[model samples]
Target chain A: MTSLTLNAIVSQMAAIEQFTNNILKILEQDARTTPAQIAVMTGRTEQEVKDQIAALEQKGIIKRYKTVIDWAKAGRERTYAFIDVKVTPSRGVGFDDVAERIYKYPEVQSVYLVSGEYDLRVVVAGTSLKEVSFFVSEKLATIDNVQATITHFVLKRYKEDFEIFEDTSEDRRLSVAP
Target chain B: MKPISHIAKTVPASGIRKFFDIVSQMDDVISLGVGEPDFVTPWRIREACIYSLEKGYTNYTSNYGLLELRKHISTYLNERWGLHYNPENQILVTVGVSEGLDLAMRAILNPGEEVLIPEPSYVSYKPCVLFAGGVPVPLGTTPESGFKVTPEQIAAAVTPRTKALLISYPSNPTGATISREELQAIVDVAREHDLFIISDEIYDRLTYEGHHTAVPELNGAYERTILLNGFSKAYAMTGWRIAYAASTPDVIEAMMKIHQYTMLCAPIMSQMAAIEAIKNCGRECDEMAEEYNRRRRLIVAGLNNIGLDCTIPGGAFYAFPSIKKTGLTSEEFSERLLFEEKVAVVPGNAFGECGEGYIRCSYATGIDQIKIALERMERFVENLGVEGRLKAAGRE
Candidate 1:
């Protein structure tokens, strides 16, 4: 293809990418935004919005719509802890194998291969502190190539997943203004 | 008993006074009538005020307001829209845009002179003019032009006694924003008529569709324009009561003379907090505008779908929808909607008589609340249709 045509195609792709980014941002803010609503908000047709969202889902970029809940407020308490792990690299695979093994347990909520002294950070949840400690000492520490671990229990959560947990804000504005 | 001053007694109360009494007594009313933002003042700005109190900076500053706050306002205006106003003599911070409007009117108007204002505008414009001992001439703008007043209409309204033209773009009831080119045409008419332009741009930052054109930025407008703006709508600082007016030195002096003698100055804490707002809260302002835009689209679309025949408002949070098809006056429609559906919207006539046959629905509430309001409105319209048919049958 000529360079001029290639440039045109590249710019067109960039525009589409920008449009997709905008749609993703809206959905991230409120997943319940329907195709028709998104269409009006983004100045696109409903069919076009539906098609883009479907494509995003197929690409795994649009993940599951999960609720951010305050379990303690809802009368369900779970002990949550963040575990820092140091691992000996297995030459080629390094910390990837150890991180995978640690994350495979059902109690592990999430695992990240992080920098600093610890090679991995693992988040775990259980019904009690003892239950969570047992998961870390018995299950996580036993993983291959794991050298040492440090665990910190979360006492209180002020905010989580971009939502303030203890929201006391009210609509104190006047009912009507000039 | 001796009567009160004639002007003070005769100046009309807000048209929403009756609705306020009823709405205050009712429970579970989802109100879309509020003109201010639903957001709390950003905590950082509030904290700045607390810090000022702790440091004992509570005494009144200059009559023109704090020099620091004025400098920041000057810099902010220049940076945002390239409009220049010297902080020392050209900017006078007032108690709110409310005070700024009063001061602008009092400073500029002579007794019996006329101020031509577009109809269906903010509630205070006419009252302020009257208090300034001026006649307010209303130039009606229809929904066919998206509630925007044309230069031709303005020219026609201009008379020898027309001393000033007052306008608020991204207006209160209709949410109409003027494009820069369109505004220039209006400015041209003002210049041709040699009329002072009092531009109340309190809703400038809340503009959704396009960038707001500061009136002073227009060619030859700076020398003739009295620009009024405030921190209320944009920074969620309505309660703070901090706003400013920028104009020529002579005009500012005139306004400051009135302000110093009557109002003295805006509160020190509000001025301090306003400085922090201008310095650090641009991002928060943008985020609020984006959210308003999203809600604006949803509410406008929902209003149209529910048979309200609303034009898309370009700025601010209001959606002015026509209720003519329902065979009810604006007041009747608003009253019935509030009583039956538990949804509160301002009757359009509250803004002006030209606003009759329409209702202003504010989309400043939550998305869920908007969705519920739309459903209620839809149900109400369907019931009205059935009731209309029944009434016709009874007549036959």
Candidate 2:
């Protein structure tokens, strides 16, 4: 392609990135922000906002809209642990195959192939400590190429999913201030 | 015992004082009263403060605040809006914009000198001027004028005794902001009159419409304008109490003289946090402004839908809606709304005389709370009888 065409493509890409970021940033903060409201806030037409969102959804860039719930506040208890796993890679597959196999279990909330001492970092959730330990020994240890597992159970969650779990900080500002 | 100083006795308590007393006693009140952000200071900025404490930085630096923080603020102002101030002598890190305003007033005003103030504005502007022994001449702004004081009004309000003109864009009570051209005209008037300019831009970052015009950036304004801005509204650091004033070195020195005698220095932890905020929290600040913009749309539309005539505020986090159609005074409307619907909105009269027929509702709270408040306000407005509703419709 000509330099002129490349420059035009680059500028267009930047514009598209900015446009999507404006809409996505708002939705990321509050998923329920309407297109009409987004239009007014972003200086775009409501129809345009709607179309852009639809296109994003179709492209699979925009996924689920979820609520960050504090389950403990709802009188329920869930024990979670971050397990570091040492994996033996198979020929030509590396950690991907083992990670895929480990993530297939229902208890695993998230699986990340991280660097450093651990080959894989898995977040597992269970109703109790014993349940998680049982899964770590029986289900996870039983898998092939799973060399060893080190589990660190979350003690008290102060925050999760960018939401503070137990925020009792009252509004300390004056009721009426300039 | 000495009758408390004549100035202190004469200056009336804040107009919102009555509501403050009453609101404090109420339970489960959905308040849109206070003009502060709902978000806590970003964790990174707060962590910076913690780190400062951990590093044992409890001692005061210079009366002008930490040099590193001042340099960061200087760079931020210049990079953000082309406003430059020397970090050494041209900036004073204040406790908040509140202190900045007070210092600006005291530093510039001579006894009995007049300061032109646009109303309804930030409540502290008039009192600050008065406390500094400057006579405050309020330039009334109306809904027809979009709650903006025109250059013509500022010119008319100016007298021979006028020492300075105080202006705040993206103003509290009304989210009104002045355009660059308009501000230039106001600055021109100030120049023509040989008056100083004190520009309180605490709500500068919260401006929703056009870009904020830093007064000092305008031609002929840099020398005379005392530019006040802070991290309170934008960075959600109100409790942290970090703000600054930028101006000429001479004026800063004079302000520093008073500050040294009284405040000495702003808290070191807050200064450290402010340094972090200015350097690294730009994205967090922008995101908060975006959130405020979304909430601004909701509350403005909600107020209009409830039969209140609300002008679209161009900036800040407030929605100043006319409650005149309800056939009640500003105080009466606010009191009734609070008692009847458990929604707390400041009466416009609390801002100024021109604000008497309106009410100032802050949109800084959560979306769900705003929605609930709007519903309650709708019911309250409906219960005001057919005559009031008819008046509202007639105005429409």
Candidate 3:
């Protein structure tokens, strides 16, 4: 009876692992996979799937759901640039303070501490190239760490967030063929 | 003044079509009925086709397909399954497995020969066999056996007229796959009976529980096997409609004969895309299979929890859940589920008669939609006294 109880516990743990792996994979591919849908796909009750998702969210495993938009295809015009920074570390904070200050800017989309010629890599987006240029010179270069900045303007985006930018091909499948 | 062929008239319209017709009339229906993958073709494969088109590869390919593409396919098959076919004469590129099946049927079948088909499979096998003038002998498999066609079953069903056995593993509707050992047993029977084997391995890459064994890989089965596979399910290239059949020289020549006049070639652009898919998109296929595996686990568990006992399907995206507890036939259950809960699932009988008391729910949709459909189905099942039946069976 004791061995049976232990085996039951082991099986229960395995089931939970299965649920976590399945839920994470679905959410990773398309966060729009609803808790209800996740339930159906996972063969768990909606409540269970929902609870697991909520737990994952609380545990920070699921940061957020995002939509991948082809801005070029959508006819939305935007300017983007990658700005590399050479920042001098503060006495105590190193690059942490400067990185935080740069990331706090609304124009800044992403910031990464790097290991190359530049100390920090910043991705910024704006309405136009002029605006992005202005942001880099006026706001980013003006930060207190106060080092040189090199900005590389993006001419074209071949792919972004796992979606190809240009996909104009029509469906070639026959309507009734198996 | 009408001239529809007798064979065309004899073949019944697919049950899937009827179910979809009803689904189309309804609004906001959460459908688990589509057989294709939810993922679009991987971008690199699509891009390869675009590249090919830009490079002026618009003309038709060789009747046997591009030698380069066939070489890559040969390499892929060899590396993945240890099965080798000479690309020059043993491979025939096709317009998806649909045309491949048709070609295989037409290539081998005499006017009155029969093809033994295991039931609860993809919808095209029976019709393709019939259209080729071969009688389709349905070999029924039961849920208790994981929907596997046992050697005993095949042995019993075989007749002198049975010239070939058509099988799809990691099956479409049932998601049932016979183990390698079990398949060897069946292959042994096929060998003893001197039957040809037409193996549809379109879903080979999608198995979750175990590796899929290509029938031709089994000893003594290669010469008699027509192994059909494609880019559709594996690479989410269904729309591309490029597939191939690998068999012995004589069988391939026979298939190519039908293919040359009828198809000329698989679309050159799609064939180019298939080359890229076969060569570069393996990781993406594995990732997609992993995603499907998760959904498979979820749907199988969800259905069984609701008293609609479902065996954990090892492959494909479908969950064949028995609706026996509700005392409703498969069609009746599908109709009511669509009408009342707005959740669309294909009736199992859409595959064959052995699927009568079951329904095939696809988990290829968004996870949220699957959950909503399951809830709606659970409610629908409870209203039909499924809970009471579960208690009576002492299964809860």
Task: Give the runs in model 1 whose Cα sits over 4 Å from its true position.
Answer: A1-22, A58-60, A73-75, A88-93, A115-117
Tell me each candidate's TM-score: 0.94, 0.90, 0.81
What tens-digit string does per-residue lDDT give for candidate 3 at B37-58?
Answer: 8888888988999999999999
Q: Per-residue lDDT for B1-396 in model 1, tens only? A: 999999999988998877878888898889999888888999999999999999999897899999999999999999988988999999999999999999999998999999999989998889999999999999888899889889999988888899999999999899999899999999999999999999999999988776899999998799999999999999989889999999999999999999999988899999999999999999999888877887898899899998999988989899999999999999999999999999999999988889999999999898779989999999999999999998989962
| Candidate 2 CAPRI grade | medium
| Whole-model lDDT per candidate | 0.91, 0.89, 0.87
Model 1 TM-score (2 dp): 0.94
Root mean square deviation (Cα) for candidate 3 = 6.6
CAPRI tier of model 3: incorrect
Q: How accurate locally is residue B57 in candidate 2, as Cα lDDT from 0 to 100? A: 92
Clashing pairs in 1: none
* All candidates in order of TM-score, best leading: 1, 2, 3
Query: Candidate 3 regions off by >4 Å?
Result: A1-110, A113-119, A123-145, A149-178, B386-396
User: Please, what are the lDDT tens digits per residue for candidate 2 over residues B164-278?
Assistant: 9988898888899889998899899999999999998888888878789999999999999999999998899998888999999999999999999999999999999998999
What C-alpha lDDT, on a 0 to 100 scale, does residue B72 get in candidate 1? 96
For model 2, the superposed segments whose C-alpha errors exceed 4 Å read A1-49, A67-76, A92-94, A128-134, B386-396
Top of the candidates by DockQ: 1
